[model samples]
Target: MTQILNGARKCFVQRGFHASSISEISAAAGVSIANIYQYFPSKEALIIALIELDLQRHRSLISRFWSTDFSPKAIEELLADIFLTPEGHAVAVLRAEIASEGARNPHVAELLRDSETGLIGSVHSLIRAAQRRGQISNELDPDLITERLSLVFEGLMRLYLFSPANGQKLIEQYYRQFADTLRLRP
Candidate 1:
């Protein structure tokens, strides 16, 4: 199942969600078409599964950050890990694909909504924790802060995908600027 999902991701990235065929996924995965069908009923199912896997990893990263006790140093590290990296061009491309697919496919859209809701909830918790510690301003609504950060993330992904060669450096600069502008207090 993992192999098939990986293959589907590779094919989708290389040929796009609509253009990529099951046979292409099978070839990429080095598995038979029949085998893929046994695991995933259709191409859409495979794409959903792949997105689910990525979402799981993302949640894990967020959870790890959530588990750490809040400190200025820890917050800085978390911000760098979350905002300053491109997460690789392949993953970025895949993310774009998923977003576009979500717009046109109801199933994908629902999955994305659920996944994003969880992500936003986790981020809101982190922001509230930081506020409690006086790392972030108490005046700012946590929900609004979370939404703004999510927009920043999406904007960075777009800029990165536009010019992947300089994406990491650009992300680093953007996050640095954002951090500097923040009124974080001890």
Candidate 2:
């Protein structure tokens, strides 16, 4: 069942939630459609499952990465490392899918919200840490600061999503700007 779910995620990432047929998913999973349906009742169910899996993975990443030891600059490097992987490529696809399919699929939209909640929390924690460590002013709104950083990160991802030719320069720009904005007092 787990294997099937992983395969289904690949199919959805590659062909998208709307266009990917059960047969394609089954073939991608190396299983029959009947067997696939035995676990997931419908294509919608499979998509939900995939999104749920990805959301959990995102949460796990945040949990693991959340630490006082690693600075935001270091975290950005870690992010770049993970996002450059083949499986990491799914992040871009998932982001694109959420933007395109959110209206048609409430599940996807909810998953996106769930993801954003975790992301925002992670950023909030980071900012709070900076304040505690005297890295940044304590008067700032952690939510707003993190939201702006997230916006920059997402904007960079958006640029990279449609045009790989534009490359990591834009992503690096985001990292530099975010780090600069979050830097400690002199």
- List where candidate 1 sits over 4 angstroms from the true fold: 64-87, 180-182
Winning candidate number (lDDT): 1
Scored by lDDT, model 1 comes in at 0.75
Candidate 1, residues 49-168: lDDT per residue as tens digits?
A: 888887887788667655565444564576455444554677778888988999999998999999999898888888778778766678878776666656776777677777776654
lDDT of 2 by residue, 1-186 (tens): 987887787888888877888888888889998999899888878777776776676667655554534465566566664455555567777767857776777777887877788778776887787688876779878877776766776787787777654545664676576566666332
Candidate 2 Cα misplacement greater than 4 A, ranges: 63-73, 118-122, 165-167, 184-186
Kindly give the stretch of ten consecutive residues in candidate 1 with the minimal lDDT sum.
177-186
TM-score of each: 0.82, 0.81
lDDT of 1 at 101: 91
Decoy 1 TM-score against native = 0.82
**Which lDDT value does model 1 have at 170?**
60
* Candidate models: Cα lDDT each: 0.75, 0.71
Clash count for candidate 2 is: 0
